[model samples]
Target chain A: MSELYQQAIKDLAAKGSERLAVPDASSTLDNPLCGDKVTLDVTTADGRIVALGHVTKGCLLCKAAATVAAEQAPGLPVAQAAALADQVRAMLKGGDAPALAGLEPFLAVRPHKSRHDCVLLPFKALAKALASF
Target chain B: MTQSIRSIIPVLARAGFHYLDNAAMAQTPGLVVEAVASHDRTARANIRRGVHEMARRADAAYDAARQSVAAFLSAQADEVVFTGGCTLALNLAAAALAEGLGPGDRVVVSAAEHHSNLLPWLMLAKRKGFAVAVLPVGPDGRLDLADLSMIDGRCKVVAVTHASNVTGAVSDIPRLAEAAHGAGAVLVVDGAQMVPHGPVDPRALGADLYAFAGHKAYGPTGVGVLWGRKEILADLPPVTWGGGMVAALDDDGIEFLEAPHRFEAGTPPVAQAVGLAAALDWMGRLDWAEIRAEEMELTARLLAGLAEIPGVRVVGPTDLAARVPVVSFTVAGCHPHDLSHVLAERGVAVRGGAHCARRLMTALGLDEGCVRASLAPYNDRSDIDALLAGLAEAIQVLG
Candidate 1:
């Protein structure tokens, strides 16, 4: 197994907290090409994310990305979470990696262009959910 | 046999690429590529129009292509009509046949049909108010012909695939033709998959109209053949109108050319047609028995290897006699897209998706689709070995 699959599997096995209570904002994103789906729920307090939960039915890469997002979302400002989404997109597109410690694992996926969408699926849903807040 | 055939494709040796996606688009032989390039360089001009020298040469080449295609299908020269591609050919047939029908007319298509065969009829049914009935496929991935009650005298056409792209199962065309003929309905066959794997004589297959794409048969893209009986061709009206198809036209009325000529609109794909002829010629020189024998061996290896994997489940028939070498499977706990990506990383190319037969995917309960490895004459046991190795690596990585 390559370092990429190993790192991605580490995030895929993460167990996060429960769904945000009556979630303040939620969004569902689907990749029509492969039928991968990700639904993200966000709860914000004082313009900061209080909690986040994700339900993903897709590839391991997608689920892993969602797990990473859920782990890093709590206590972060909504704007920062949205910015992290942008950073993730840039990282997948072969740009320089962001300084966030949690995002270091995604550096392994840089060389695979076909999997960029898989890594971005959860990010896009989270961005939409954060935007609603 | 495999080494000899592989020598004709330069990329196989140069790039060391294991091409397992022949069911989608075949790798054009070096000779066929040269045929297309040489035609473009030397004899490129508008055919059937100008009276100049180059025009005449172009006309001769185009005519030769038509004759070659007709001969390949065991059809007369006048029975063949060239179209943009297989989809266009099927659409043309559907449009022309639907013109003679009314609201109460019916058209029956199998559930296993590619979208190209199913969509045209559904569009025609919507426009002409004809009812479209679907013939269900059994669990074995073969069409259930047990219930032919839907194909009654009211049925105007019965369109089906000669072989399924997803299942690799060959349909019993002769029996279908007989049933359609008994019900006074014309049989239209989508021969896109069958023609590439073996010889197909449309008349002997009892099809009134047969459509196939050139690229699927190691020919160039943008060219396809639609062969119909002379009488049937005459009865159907031309769907497209343009400069080349008409004999004489005025504000009063228009007189069109006969049969095949009337169907070709605007400028035809002359070079592509030539390439298709060259491909057919190349295929004709090969011994089909040898090709089939090699493919069967490779297929056996693939099925056996996949069967050994605990989580892998093969779709379609498990027996060699029932299908071709097109094998589709789903791996537990692994998405097909991810698996395909891993295989591509390993320098093996295969198709992963619904394969343009979403209905078949649904029928097989593969909601997330499956990975497909399709074999061709150029493929040998080593290619299958590479595939199995790649698959094993994918499972280990994605696990």
Candidate 2:
């Protein structure tokens, strides 16, 4: 039994379903190795993200990451959200976990280097979407 | 018997590594490793146009390797051109063949081709102004050549894989060969997946050209073979140019050597080629019929076991007819990567994802890709049991 697929991750992955038909900015990213894709849509106001939606067709790690992004990104400044993504990226590379409970479950993914991108795909998409803002 | 074969490969001696990733790269035997090391130690010198004794020895070793590859393909020594790998070999063929094509011409390729075999022609078509017509695959993952009109008068070449790396379904090469020849187009078969299993005769398969990699056939990496028909190669221009390929050079112009030499550019992978030849020699001496029977038996067992598992859907042909030992499947709720990770924890080595056949994956409706377990001669019942047991645990853990 791998700790990476714990009940908390599975619950978050099951909640990975929110999409905005129209948004101020949107970006799609794919893992060229496995062909897993994540498309994120964002709407911002007053230099802060007001709403976020994502359509992720990927593994549990990718879905869980997207769910966490959707849950924590709203009502936060764009730069802070970008920082969160960077923190997740840093944590996957053996750095300290992000100062958020949703992302703490992904600490088990640190050693599996190939799957680091799975946890970072939505975060990368979030950064890309925020960059357009 | 399997233990004896396993003993021949140094890496397989490791106790717990159940390697089911032969489709990516097979384990190299000790004979091939020694052949490469011995060549690098004793005969390491530039090939062709050298007066030293070391260069003479290098030339002899390289020429002998070419002859061995020729024998493996049932081809002439002058018809084989050694390339960096299978991708380069296919690119060499595509670039040279594209010269005869134009805007209105068409090149027919199957949907089951690896990216290496498909991308070169697609990229060449964009630059050379030719149309690429894709042949669709049936539900069983075999090419559906029912509509022969795609190979009409404008067809210039028919490029396809001899066996699909993802689905393991073997293509109907004779039918494809007849169609290509009927339309006055040449048939180029990507034999990378097929050659590792056994020797092949390109002429017998009615292919004008064939390409395969050495690393996938229990040989060293960085070496591959591109075998073409004598007359067809004689007429094609060289896609690359370098020292050994030029027979005469001046300020006015340059005259190239004949077919094989004209296509070989730069210093080739001499030691890798020597290792490939040694691998092929070892394969030739094996009882292929017995090995193939054992492989098919395992395939049958795997298929039956997969069928009994709920939510496991096979992506290729279900039976032992016209397929290799490669098996690909998908679980309903579990992603291939997740399942692969779980299986890895159990010491099972399998490949997940598109397997470099994205077009086929799209056609098969595998949005998240599928898990693939490919078998070689060295694998035994223990390997399959480990794979099945690992999958059960993976589903329980991830599903």
Question: How many angstroms is residue B100 displaced in model 2 relative to the true structure, after the best TM-score fit?
Answer: 1.5
lDDT tens digits, residue span B1-399, model 2:
567789899999888889999999999999999999999899899999888988999999999999999988888999999999898999999999999898999999999999999999999999999999999999979899889799988998999999899989999899999999999999999998898888899999999999999999999999998999999999999989877899889999999999899999799999999999999988988888888899999999999999989999999999888888999999999999999998988889999999999999989998889999999999999999999989999999986
Where does candidate 2 chain B have its weakest 10-residue lDDT segment?
Answer: B1-10
Cand. 1 TM to true fold: 0.90
- Give fnat for candidate 2: 0.91
Q: How well is candidate 1 docked (DockQ)?
A: 0.48
Question: Tens digit of lDDT per residue, candidate 1, span B152-264?
Answer: 99988999999889878888899999989999999999999888887679999999999999999999999999999999999989999986899888898999999899999
Q: Model 2 misses residue A130 by how many Å?
A: 1.4
- Itemize residue pairs with steric clashes in candidate 2: none
lDDT on C-alpha atoms for all candidate structures: 0.87, 0.91
Cα-based TM-score, every candidate: 0.90, 0.98
The interface root-mean-square deviation of each model, in the order shown, is 1.8, 0.9
Relative to the true structure, candidate 1 has a C-alpha RMSD (angstroms) of 2.9
Q: Show where candidate 1 strays beyond 4 Å.
A: A13-29, A39-54, A69-91, A95-112, A124-133
